[model samples]
Target: MNAPGHVLVVGASAAGLSTAEALRRKGFGGRLTLIGAEPEPPYDRPPLSKQVLSGAWEPTRAQLRTKEVLDALDAEFLLGDPAAALDVERRSVSTASGTTVSADAVVVATGITARTLPGQSGLRGVHVVRTVADSLALRSALLKARRVVVVGDGVLGAETAATARLMGLEVCVVGPQPAPMTGQLGPFVAGHLAALHTGNGVGLRTGVLLDALLSQDGAVTGVRLSDGEEVAADVVVAAIGCSPCTDWLAGSGLDLDDGVVCDAHCRAAEGVWAVGDVARWHHQGLGRLLRLENRTNATEQALAVAGNILGEDRPYLPVPYFWSDQFDVRLQVFGVPSAENTVEVVEGDPAEGRFVVRYDGPRGPVGVLGWRMPKQARLHRAGLVDHYTQPLEPTAP
Candidate 1:
């Protein structure tokens, strides 16, 4: 494959920026342009829910790179205009601001949009943390509110609940799982996290789904559960999952399932590639299509996509990884861990608050988890690496 003379990357966040940086490092001097929906420069979003919301770190601290470093990239950054439509054949993108960009290659890194409850749009005191403005608004609401009901028990909901509790507000988490992060961490480890949250004065109302958002006078009053329970609150945070940002790619004549479906090499079509949360690529090692939303995948996948664009011809197969920080605990997971997997403590003691656990499936160890034991967990992650590296067994017809 030959290097593209010009590459246009949509969604100028971590993935797009990393792709541009990777291209430069790989000795490609092609023309590069990054288009972003947000007006701000490329910034880190992981801290927006924690440090930025907690007021421990300023909003500017979430910037992924300093001005000097970004300037050094020597790429044209088209900020504040979101991609409205894509032309897969011509490899061009039309922005919402009426700007059309054409390139020899197009990279779709639009990422995902946070899910929100019904009637959450115009309502005051209801928040979802996806951008910097969202974090600031939620923080302001938290300071003025006495009670907050986080309507989800996933990672974002749990973290937001923890931060709210730390800020001296009464916090309660409502979700359909038995415990927080049950889907991500599995039941056994999520139970420990449940205890941690309860011990820290965070309320838990799991195993129930939200019926509706209760509001009064255009402000969120609380939320109603399907079980007919109405939890009172001055503010509400909806952290329910997210969907890929493929709305712009509609009618682009490219495959769009849950995301921009791509090949093993992250190529969507001829001279077209996809990266970050918006990419659902075939994992040759796993023998299936996979999409990851974590911060790590955003950058790592970008590097792979850049290499493939420059003719590396390598499949983008990686062991999925994600980490979360809540209260004082830092949980790290390598590979996927589901609630149905059987988990075993591999190192340290669970009672000591620092241990590593391994998740096993019918075949073998599939994931490794670190409960404040990052180094040990990383060492044990080698156990799951082979599962991704080894050739998968052929499926019977």
Candidate 2:
């Protein structure tokens, strides 16, 4: 396929900005346009839950690039105007402002929207930190809140709870998982996290479902658990999860399965490609469609998509790495970790608050996790590529 003369990138966050910048870096001199639903320029999201929420850094410090840096790319940016529809056949995107932009190729990087608790709408002190505005609002609410209930046990939820605790709020984390981050880090590693939270005076409640948000006088007062118990709270932050922002691509003739389904090369259609959290592309290693929701994957996939747009047929195969910072512990993982996998301590000791752990699948060691031991984890991560490709041993039925 010939290189496109003009490229349109939808959703100007980390993935979208990286895609446009990569096209320029890769010598694509054609016209480039980036469309964003948010009014602000691309900014770092990881810090939103940490430094920014903790009042250690200003929101402006989270920007990925300054106006001067963004302008140097020479791309037309359409901010705050979200794409309302897509005409894949005509290779055009229509914004909510009644503007239609055409391009030879389109890159979808709309990313994900945070999931909220049911009946949370119009309730005061109920927040989800997905954007700068969200973090700002939640941070403001945290200052006045004495008892904060954080829903979900994922990275975002855990991080938020940790931040709230550091800010001296009586924080309670409620989730359905047996332990925090159990799905990603497995039970053994997650046990340490549970201890970390509880040790810091953060209440950890697991294996329970959230029944409903209790509000009185248009303000959130507590959360009712499935066990018929109400946990009182002055503020509630729902870090449940996120879904891809692909509502605009409903009738675009592209496959949408939780996310914009794409091939191994991140190509959704003939001239349409998907990147970032909104993309569910075939993972060559996993032999299945996987949608990653991390900053690393977003940037890496954006670069790969840019290469594919330039006629490179490289498959987007990654080790699937992620990290989280809670309290004084920095947890990092490389490759996939499953609860069923056999976990072993590779270095250090878990009791010491620093260690390198390896998760062995049927084939071999498929993942390495570091708790305050990043250098060692990185060294072990090199072995995951080989183990990921090795055929797994069949389990007895």
Candidate 3:
């Protein structure tokens, strides 16, 4: 296929910016237009819950690229205007501002929005961290809050609780999981994380279902749990999860499930490719459609999509890596971590807060997790392919 004359990227964050930059690096001298819902330029999101929330870094410091670097890309940036519709047949995208932009190829990298709890809308002192503005607002609230209750036990939740505690706020984290980040790090490693949070003066309440958010005159007061217990909170931060930003493509005739469904090459249709958190592409190794929301996957997948857009028919096969920092621990993971997998200590000691653990599936070791042992994790990551290809053992019902 010939190189497209023009490419339209429907996001301005890491994935979109990476795709545009990769296209230029791949020698595609085409017209590139990057559109974003936020007025801000491309910025890093991983530090929002940590540095930004803790008042250690300003929001501008999270920029993915400087103005000089962005200008060097020579791409048109349409900021603050969100795409409302995609006319795939006409090869055009209509924004909320009622302007239609035509392109030879389109890269959907809209990413996702933070998921909110039920009855959370229009409530004061209730926050969900996703964008820079979200972090700024929550940071301001934390300064004035006395007690903060963070819902969910994912990476964002754990990070938020840590930040809140750092700001001297009495912090309590509530989640339905057995341990914080259990879904990603598994139970054994997550137990150590739970101890870490507790050691740092943060409360942890696990395996409890949140029934509703109790409010007093349009302001959040506390949360009611399924066990009929109420936890008083001056502020509530819901770090449950995020949903893909795919509502704009509702009737675009493209496959849309949890995200923009795509093939192994990240192609949704002819001239249409999806990347980043908004894309759920088929993983050749896992044999399933997987959507990764981490910063690494966003940039890595964008590069793959860019190459495919330039007529390189390569399948994207990644080792799947993500990391999180909370209190004094730095947790790094490679490959898929499943609860069904048997975990074994590979190196170091979990109690000492410097260790490496491997997740062994029915066939063999499928994942490697490191706590302050990134070097060891990288070493074990290369062996994931061999384990992934091994035949699975039969399981009892």
lDDT of 3 by residue, 175-272 (tens): 99988988887889888989899999999889997899999999999999888889999899999999999999999999999999999899999999
lDDT of 1 by residue, 1-397 (tens): 5788999999999999999999999998989999999999999999988999999999999999999999999999999999999988888999999999999999999999999898888998899988898899999999999999999898899989999999999999999999998888888899999999999999899899999889888988999998999999999999998999999988889999999999999999999999999999998878889999999999999999999999999998798999999999999989987788998998999999999999998888989999999999999988888788776879789
**For model 2, the run of ten residues with the poorest summed lDDT:** 386-395
Model 3 whole-model lDDT (C-alpha atoms): 0.91
Q: Pick the lDDT winner.
A: 2
Predicted structure with the largest TM-score when compared to the true one: 1
Q: Please give, for residues 1-397, the per-residue lDDT of candidate 2 as tens digits.
A: 7999999999899999999999999999999999999999999899999999999999999999999999999999999999999999899999999999999999999999999889998999999999999999999999998999999999999999999999999999999999998987899988999999999999988999899999989999999998888999999999999999999999899999999999989999999999999999988777789899998998999999999999988988888888999999998889888889999999998878889999998767889999999999999998898655433345487
Ten contiguous residues with the weakest lDDT in model 1: 384-393
User: Where's the lowest-lDDT run of ten residues in candidate 3?
Assistant: 386-395
List the pairs of residues colliding in candidate 1. none
Compare candidates 1 and 2 on lDDT and give the better one. 2
Q: What's the CA error at residue 342 for candidate 1, in Å?
A: 1.3
After superposition, the stretches of candidate 2 with alpha carbons farther than 4 Å from their true spots are 388-397
Q: Per-residue error at 190 for model 3, in Å?
A: 1.2
C-alpha positional error of residue 132 in candidate 1 after TM-score superposition, expressed in Å: 0.8
- Candidate 1 vs candidate 2: the TM-score winner is 1
TM-score of 3: 0.97
Candidate 2 TM-score to native? 0.97
RMSD of each: 0.9, 1.9, 2.3
Backbone-clash count (model 1): 0
